[model samples]
Each structure stands twice: as C-alpha cells, then as structure tokens.
Target chain A: MRGITITLASLLILTLISVVFANYAHGYMVFGILILAALKFIGISFCFMELKKAHSFWKVGLLLFLVLFMISVLFLAK
Target chain B: MESKILNHKNIYYPPGGILIWIIIFLELITFGIALIVMVFYGQKELEIFHTSRLQLNTTIGTINTLFLITSGYFMARSVSYLRKGQKEKSSLFLKLTMLGGLFFLGLKTIEYYFKIEAGLTVGHNTFFTFYWMLTLFHVIHVIVGLVILTSVLVGLRKNPSKVAIEDVEASAAFWHMCDLIWLLLFPVIYLLF
Candidate 1:
C-alpha cells in the first residue's frame, strides 16, 4: 500500500511537471513531456503492476519497449 | 504439475501470468505502431495537425489522465487486498476502480459530444481521423475492461474464498493496460502535436 501510494504520488508529480513544461517551457516541450510520460509509465509498470517482482526478462523487455518508443517519437518529432 | 508450476515463482509467470502479459505486449505494440503512424502523418500535415490538436481540450485530456491513473491505483489496491484475504476491502476498491472508469467515460463522452457539435468528426481531416480512431479504440478497451472488472467483482461477492488470485490479477492487468495505453496516447495526441 505504501509503495502504491508513493508510486501514485510520483506519477501525479511527473504529470504536473509535464503540464508545466507543456505550457510554460516552449523549447523541448515535447522532449520534456515524453520523458515525463516515460517515467510515469515505468512507475505504473514497476510498482503498480508489480513488474518489479516479475522476472528480469519481462522487466527488461518492458524497459526496452519504452526506450525504443521514446527514441522513435523523438526522432520523428525532430 | 501445471498448477504447481503456476503457483511457483517461475520466470515465465508475471503477476498476471504469461498469457495476459503476452496480450498486454501485443496491445501495446499495436497502439505504439498506430501512434508512430499518427506522428508520421502529423509531421507530413503539420499545419492541419496543429490546428486540429489545438481544437482539443487539453484540460479535459489531463482530467481523464487523472481519472485513469487513479482508477489504476484503485485496481492495484483491490488486487493487494484480495491477496491478503480481505474480500470486503478488495471489493470496495474494485468498485472504486470501476467508478473511476465510469467517470472517464462520462467526461470523454462530453468531450466527444463537443467535438461532434463543432463538426470535428473523423472525416474532418487527417488529425481528427487519427484522433477518433485511436481514442475510440481505446474507449472500447476501457469498456471491455469495465465488464471484466464487473465480473471479477461479482465473483468476489458470490464466493470470496473461491476467487482465484490469478483471475483477479489478470483482470487487474487488463485494467492497467487501459491506463498504460492512455498514458501513451494522452501526451502524444493532446500535447505533443
């Protein structure tokens, strides 16, 4: 429960950060928002979904997916 | 032997088991490809994409994000409680999770209504096309997720002792998939372009 609470708080904070960057920070807004989204994604996966307790294979695979997706988004956005 | 394998902490078995994880991965990949395609087209029609995106209500998008995230949190709690043999608490959290989903659908319906009133249908343009396609598909997933959760809730109510943790975990996994997909979609569709 504590873990999930912390995860939820972290996600909310990351979301707030993204919103702030989207509105106030003009340059690298996309970059910042996507990065924050990635963090939120990891938080939900590891803590909320209990991926942290899962096999190393699944954890690493999920991380790889996120990294590849982020790279693609950034490259395309550029 | 198979039950023992499932009960043991094997590398193949995730929280929700291998099958659901496979489905989750497939779903994520599908959405990822669609998003990449949407982004590619957005670059091609930058002006149209930007104008259409500007028509979107970012505030509503953000609120819906909050709703899904909270819903996911509730679901995690539900599963946790069930594991601890606290059926009542688990049921309560499960209901809260469903409520969160309902709230999301309600707000999304309102947003969709406004978009339709403004003539922002799927045929409006390229941007609207992707918007409707991706979001409507996601909405369908959320509705399916709700049905699954409802069934789980009923099972818990009917026979708590007979409820399988694996089943609850599977349902929770599916619910979180909706949250995960939205996390991917919201920023890209609403904020990125």
Candidate 2:
C-alpha cells in the first residue's frame, strides 16, 4: 500500500512537471516529457504490476523493452 | 512433483501468467509501432499535425490520465487485499477501480463529441487520423478491461474463497496495460505534437 501510494504520488508529480514546464523546456520538451513518462512506466510496472515479486527475467526484459522504446522515440523525434 | 511445477511456474510465469504477459508485450509493440509511425508523419506534416494537435483538449487529457492512474492504483490495492484474504476490502477497491474507468470513458466520450462536432473526425487530417485510430483502439481495450474486472468482481462476490489470485492478477494486468498504453499515448498525442 505504501509502495503504491508513493508510486502514485511520484507519477502525479512527474505529470505535473511535464505539463507545467512544457513551454519553458522549449526544444527539449519532448525529451523531458518522454523521460517523465518512462519513469511513470517503470513505477507502474514494478509496483502496480507487481514485477518486483516476479523473477529477474521478467524484470530485466521489461526494463530492456522500455530502454529500446525510449531510444526509438527519442531518435525518431529528433 | 506438484511443488516442483509450482516453483517453475513461480519462476517463469508472472502474477498473471506467461500468456497474459505475452499478450501485453504484443499489444505494447503494436502501439509502439503506431506511435513511432505517427511521430514520423508528424515530422513530415509538421504544420498540419501541430495545428490539429492544438484542437485537442489538454485539460481533458490530463484529467483522464489521472483517472486511469488512480484506477490502476485501486486495482493494485484490490489484488493486494485479495492476497491477504480480505474479500470485502478487495471488492471495494475493485469497484473504485471500475469507477475510475467509467470516469475516463465519460470524459473521453465528451472529448470525442466535441471533436466530431468541430469536424475533427478521422478523415479530418493526418493528425486527426492517428488521433482517432490510436485513441479509439485504446478505448476498446479499456472497455474490455472493465468487462474483465466486472467478471472478477462477480467471482469474488459469488465465491470469495474460490476466487483464484491468478485470475485477479490477470485482470489487473490487463487493466494496467490500458494505463500503460495511455501513459504513452497521452503525452505524444496531446503534448508532443
């Protein structure tokens, strides 16, 4: 429960940061938003999806997937 | 032998089982490709995409994200309570999760209505095309997820002890997939371009 609460709070804060600083971030806005999103994605996967209790294989696989996804998005956006 | 099988399952299968995870990965890949393609097109049709994207209601998008994330938190709580043998608490959390989903659908419907009224249909432009296609597909997933959750809730109410944790986890996994997809979709569509 505490874990989820903290995860939720972190996600909300990240979201607000993405929204609030979007204009100020200028050219780097997309990168910042995607980074925040990647963090939220990890939080949900580990806490809400209970990947923390799962085997190392699944955890590592998901992290790899996220990294690949981020690289692709950032590359394409650039 | 049974203990060995259980141990193997624990190591290989996640909370929802390997099958659901496979489906989740496939879905994520599909959406990922679509998003990348959308971004590629956005780069080419920068003007059309930017102007059309501004038609979107960022406030509504942000609210829906909150709804889905809170719903996901409720679903995680539901599964946690069920594991602790607290059926009532679990059921309550399940209902709250469903409520959050309903709120999302409601807001999305309103947003869609306004878009259609403003002639921002799928045929409107390249951006609207991707917007309608990706978001509508996601809406379908959320609807299916709600149905799965409803079934799990029914099972819990009918025979609490008989309700399997694996089943609940499977449903929760599906629900979180919706949240995950939206997490990717919202920023790209509404904020990025």
Candidate 3:
C-alpha cells in the first residue's frame, strides 16, 4: 500500500516535469523527447505493473507487434 | 498465495484469445495498407500533407499520451490488487483508470472543436482524414475498454471469484495494448510532420 502511494506520487511529479520540458521542445527535439518520455513511462509500467513478469508469449508477441508498428511508422515518415 | 501465481509450465490456448488475435492481425493489416497508401499520397503531394498537419495540436496529443500510459499502469495495478483480494484498492485503481480515459476523451473533444474552428474537417486533406480516423478509432476503443473495466469493478463488488480476477487481468491487458498503440501514434502523427 505504501509503495503504491509512493509510485503514484512520483508519477504525478514526473508528469509535471515532462510537461515543463515538452512545452519548450521544437523540430527533431520534439519527437526525440517524446520518445524518451514514452520509454520512461513504459519502463515504469512494466516494472511497477508487473508486465515484465507476464507470460513469455505475451512478451514476445508485444515485441513483434512493436517491431511491425515501428517499421510502418518509419515507412510513412520516410 | 500459491494459487494466485499462474502456472508458467503450460499456457492454455483459449479459443477466445485466438479469436481476438485474429481480429488484431486483421486490423494490423488494415493499418499497414493505410500507412502505405498515405506514404504514396504524401510522396506525390507533400505540400498538402504538411499544411494538414498544422491543424494538429502537439501539446494536447503529448498530454493525452501520458494520460493513457498512466491509465495502463492503473489498470495493471488494479488487477494486481484484485489478485491479492484487496477489493478497495482494486476499485480505486480501476476508477483512476476510468478517469484517465475520460481525461483523454475530454481533451480529444476539445481538439475536435479546434479542428472544426480551423476548418480542418476529415475532408480537408489526407492527413486530416487519417488523423481523425486513427485517433477517433482509438478513442472509441478506450471508451469500450473503460466500460469493460467498470463492469469488472461491479462484478468484483457483487460476486468475485478467480474467474472474475482472470477476466479483469485479460481486459486490462487489452486496455494496455490500446494505450500502447496510442503511445506510438502520438509521435507518429502529431509530433512528426
């Protein structure tokens, strides 16, 4: 219970911090920072939410899905 | 405690899971085609695409991404609490997740209003059309996921069981996938021109 409370509090803090930084970014820096914040949030979700310990199939399936998604996004961006 | 830990030695191949995967695979194909078509269209007409992108509000999209990502965490934690038989904690987290969905939807509606005010309807250009289609599709999904999660909370209150617990976990996983997809889309469509 206490740990959950601390995690939620930190999330709120991190969000505020990200928002402050996000407001100033422009051009390539914008997408770059968004990706960084995204990776950070995913890390927190996986670690604190126990998604890392989910089934191996799920983990591998998620990786495959991400790969395909990235390829499509990059294809369009080009 | 022991029973709560799902067995890793054998993964069941449920028909429902398989069916859902089929649907997801189909959607993936649709998105792939859409991406390819948009790329071709953009290659032939770059100016129109760039102008259409100016209609989007990057700040709102970024904020919504954070909102849904946090919601995914809440949904996952809700399941973890339910697994531990902490009904109140589970309900609280589920409610928080629902609020996250509401928050995203609220911001999206505001964005829609801006697009309308700027005369950026779906018919404006290919980018506008795809933007509205993709995000609104995701918005509908987040709403559906919220409904399922709310029902799970109600079930937990009425007659909780291991099956209810598993249902909540599976539903949360689906919600997380939805959230993650939006996380990827936020940058793809909104941040990048």
Candidate 4:
C-alpha cells in the first residue's frame, strides 16, 4: 500500500516537472523519460503483478514482443 | 474430483487464468508499438510539442493518475480478499475500480474539449497529431477496461461464484498497465511539450 502511494506521488512529481518545461526537453531528455517510463512499468509488472509466478515462456514472449514492436515503430517512424 | 479452489490449505494446479494473461500481454505489445511510432515521427517537432505542453492541465492528469493508482490498490486488496473468501469486499473493490475508470474518461473528455478549443487539433502538426492520437488511443483502452470491469461487477453481483476471480485480477493488472503508460505519457506530452 505504501509503495503504491509512493509510486503515485513520484508519477505526479514527474508530470509536474514535465509541465513546467514540456517544450524544451530534447531527445536526450526524452530518452531519459523513456527509461523512467520503462522502469515504472517493470516495477508494476514484476513487483506488483508478481510476474515471477507466471510461466517463463510468457515472460520471454513479452520481452521479445516489446523489443520487436519498438524496433518496427522506430523503423517506420518519421 | 471435488472442487479445486485456492483456499487456506488447498491450491489448484495450472490455474485456469493463464489465458487472460496472454491477452493482456498482447494488448500491451500493440500499445507499445503505437507509442514508439508516435514519438519517432514527432521527434522533429519537439519545439511545438514543448510549447503545446503548457496548454494541458497537469493537475487533471495528476488527479487521474491518483484515481487509477487508488483503483490498482483496491484491485490488489480485492484479490487478497477473494483468496480469503471475502466476496462482498472483493466485489465492492471491483465496483470501485469501474468508478475510477469512469472518472478518468470524464476528465479526458474535458481535456479534449479544452485542447480543441485551443486550436490543438490532431492535424495541426506532427506533434499535436501524435499527442491527440496517443492519448485517444489510451482513452479507448480505458473504455475497454471499463467495459470488462463492468461485466465483472455485474457477474459478481448476480453470481460471484461463477465469475473467475483470477480473471478479474488479470484484467485489473492490464488496467494498471494502461495507467502506468499514461503516467509516462501525460508528463511527456503535457509538461515537456
């Protein structure tokens, strides 16, 4: 419960930080944001959802899917 | 063969809820792809993206995030309650989750109206296009989640026993994933625009 609250707090702070200077951030900063986003998702999946209990095949499948999808999106991106 | 359930001392094998997990995973993959494409295409218009960020109301975004987080907490609690055979508490939480979904959609609609009035249409530019598309895509998922949650709630009320509690948990997990994605997106689009 406490952890969930903390996550929510951090999310708010991040949103505020972005709103404060939403326009000036460059690719480097965007990359940092992406990392933060990925980390948050990982926390929820592994910590909260207990992905460890899930089958190894499904876990691998998810990782592979993300990788491939991201690559495709970047490949076709403007 | 007697009843196979996860009680105080009896745990079932090969839980029948695995299929739902696969569905959630697939949906996440689709959303992730869309996110990457939007960011990639809109990279050149980072300036407009930043300027437009000011137009969005961060407070609303924060509120929605908190609402979803609370829902996630309730979802986790409801699962625990289910394991303990506390049906009423579990159903209540499920209903609460649905309410959170509705609240988010309402705020999103208001946000959209504000954006349209501010001359931030999807076709305005690459940045605005991605902004509207990505957020709306997310909104669609939220709607889907709300529908699934409503079904679960209705089932819980009519015949709680027939409804697969684990399946409910799985749906809630996907809903949280959607929430987490927006937690990242709201800041990236609105704050840093």
**DockQ metric for all predictions:** 0.72, 0.65, 0.23, 0.26
The whole-model lDDT of each prediction reads 0.91, 0.88, 0.64, 0.64
Show what share of the native A-B interface contacts model 2 retains.
0.59
lDDT of 1 by residue, B45-112 (tens): 99999888889999899889999999999999998988777889999999999999999999999999
Worst 10 residues of 4 chain A by lDDT: A69-78
Q: Give lDDT: candidate 4, residue B1.
A: 9
After superposition, candidate 2 runs with Cα above 4 Å error: B1-10
> In model 1, where do residues sit more than 4 Å from their true spots?
B1-9
> Model 4, range A11-59, lDDT digits (tens) per residue?
5455445444434666655444444545555555654565545566655
What proportion of true contacts does candidate 1 retain?
0.61
Please write out the lDDT profile of model 4 over residues B100-150, one tens digit for every residue. Answer: 888888998998898899887999777777778788888988888788777
Per-residue lDDT tens digits for candidate 1, residues A1-78, read 998998998887887778778878878888899999999999998888999888888998899999999899999988
- Backbone clash count, each prediction separately: 0, 0, 0, 11
Candidate 2 per-residue lDDT, tens place, B142-177, comes to 999999999998988887767778778889999999
lDDT of 2 by residue, A1-78 (tens): 997999998988888787776656787888898899899899998899988878888888888888888888889878
Task: Please identify which of the two predictions, 1 or 3, would achieve the higher TM-score against the true structure.
Answer: 1
Weakest 10 consecutive residues, lDDT, candidate 1 chain B?
Answer: B1-10
Error of 1 at B164 (Å): 0.3
The predicted structure with the larger lDDT, 1 or 4, is: 1
For residue B193, what is the lDDT in candidate 4? Answer: 36
Evaluate candidate 3 by giving its C-alpha RMSD to the native, one decimal: 4.3
Q: At residue B104, give the lDDT of candidate 1.
A: 100
Strongest candidate by TM-score: 1
Better of 1 and 4 by DockQ: 1
Q: What class would a CAPRI assessor give candidate 1's docking?
A: medium
